[model samples]
Target: MLIVTGYVQVEPTELAQFCNEFSALATATRRRSGNLSYSAAVDDPQDGRLLVVEQWEDQASLSAHLEAADTVAFVDRWRGRMLGNIEKYDASNKRGLMD
Candidate 1:
């Protein structure tokens, strides 16, 4: 499985607009093939900080999602509206406590 996590910071005044755009993108993303889950949360509303979490079936699925037109468009639309970097992690569902 593939896991992605990150946080973005936007201007407090633009939180609502940013969230609207993010919601549209997230909804579309969740419908894509191979998508396991996609979500975003407000970490600090006063600071306009938001956290994102995503899970994919594999690297290929994640890559396809990244290359999707909607994904590209969303990035372009929100490029200057937020600040943060996303990181990805490779994981396996081993039958263990740590898993």
Candidate 2:
């Protein structure tokens, strides 16, 4: 299994639009067979930070998701709107046990 954590910072004024689109893509991501989950949350009230907790069956499965239309679109469109940085992390099956 693979666990991917993604962090995105948005402009305070642009957070609402960012969340609207991200939430839709996350919903579709969770519907995929290889997807264990695709959940996201903001850091705090009025904060522009967003964190995504994603789980997939394996590396190949996650790669497939990377090619998915929704995923691709989200990457292309939202990337420019993002603030400072976007962070990513991967955890293998054994490491994921702690989750």
Using all chains and alpha carbons, the TM-scores for the candidates as numbered come to: 0.89, 0.79
What tens digits encode model 2's per-residue C-alpha lDDT throughout 3-87?
7776678887888888899889988888887898888789853668877788788778888889998889888897777754434
- State the weakest 10-residue window (summed lDDT) of model 2: 84-93
Candidate 1 error regions (>4 Å): 94-99
Most accurate candidate by TM-score: 1
lDDT of 1 by residue, 1-99 (tens): 889999989999999998999899999999988899999999999999999999998888999999999989988887887798789998875367875
Give residue 6's lDDT in candidate 1 (0 to 100).
96
Error of 2 at 20 (Å): 0.6
Top candidate by lDDT: 1
Each prediction's whole-model lDDT (CA): 0.90, 0.78
Error of 2 at 3 (Å): 0.9
